[model samples]
Target: MPKDKPLNAAARFQKTLDFSAADYYDQCRNRTYACCFSVENSPYIWENYANGSEKGKACIVFEFGKLRAMLNSALNPEGAILFYNGNSCRQIFEVNYGLVHYVPWGSHRTNEKHLSNPILYTYLKSDRFCEEHELRISLSAIGIGHFALKDGSLIEFPPTLQLGFDFRNAIASAAIREILLAPGADSSFLKTELSKLRIEPAPTSEKK
Candidate 1:
């Protein structure tokens, strides 16, 4: 929504929408936060995410079911709500996880269903990235304003929001299956740090 950049370029499809649909898309973008993972152990992901740095990259493999369960239990408690903007904004905290749907970038036609359901639009991506086999976990809290105010005017909040989870405990339990180091990563350093957390680095070929 901010700019037609690589990560959010799919948002450009908003141009195809009328005012009402575009307004809904903007609302969804403001309230949703998403995290992406690959179903495969990809060298491309390692290289790009690490910004071509060789020695500091590592990936932790999670058991999908366990990870999802932990996240749902921790983040989405029953009956959570926030009162804002003269309304009771019920917390629609969803732990939705699934494979991403990729379409050709040149295909710009708007789907009727997607116009009605703007949140689903978040799962669409350019087919150029299909090789990543991406799985996304999106959390949304609708009807709440993510902003700050100073002196009776709106102030800019940080670009990213921090959502906390008990990951250390989850890792100690069954949420994490293994940790894989990149080709040139400092294995010894990582192993030592993981040791403090009682996690041992495992071979990349190891299966959950």
Candidate 2:
């Protein structure tokens, strides 16, 4: 779809539904900005992606937008603080945006945390909800990958299907109050880790 077409399609979608004016507005917004929501005091849930162990109690949620903006203003940062599982075989993740971007450092999962690692990066094959979905991070060990549902519903993929990254940056793009980071992650660490990544803006040709 073209850049201008989404809004027009969204408008048409709204009119076809039997929703009232107010309800129609809400539905259109939901469709236009899928996976977006407020999380002022919303409870966060965390678990071992490889195992179902309860690790939610150890995580600390921060507004990603505020943190991102604040860190950009700083200079000579150290490294972002990230939660560690202390176990090599287990992977821990917050269930909100399906984060798979692991902080690289002295950790057991050394191979999984690198920003440029091919196993961690993924091309978005398809999405059932978000329109602005594309290349995502896939944490295969936990059965989660890119373009996965944001409603926190887990599904098993076929053994032959290789998964990609699952982190949700779009839904958390503006004033990301709902995105969850590891419990101990800090600005300095995030700066150091992010600086090492070969990230770039997606090309216009890739946007669906």
**Which model scores highest in lDDT?**
1
Pick the TM-score winner: 1
lDDT of 2 by residue, 1-208 (tens): 1222334333332444543333333332222211222223323223322133333222224455554454333211233222222222222221123223333223223222221222222221223322332223222222113223335443333333221221234223533233244454354554454446543334679643
Q: Give the Å shift of residue 78 in candidate 1.
A: 3.2
Candidate 1 has an lDDT of 0.65
Provide the clash count, candidate 2. Answer: 16
TM-score of candidate 1 on Cα atoms, chains taken together = 0.69
lDDT by residue for model 1 over 11-121, one digit each (tens)?
Answer: 334454333445546666766778999998977787667665546788989999899888777665564443344444444556578788887767444452333355666
Q: Which regions of candidate 1 deviate over 4 angstroms?
A: 1-19, 52-54, 79-92, 143-158, 195-208
- TM-score against native, each model: 0.69, 0.18
Each model's C-alpha lDDT? 0.65, 0.31
Compute the lDDT of residue 61 as modeled in candidate 2. Answer: 43
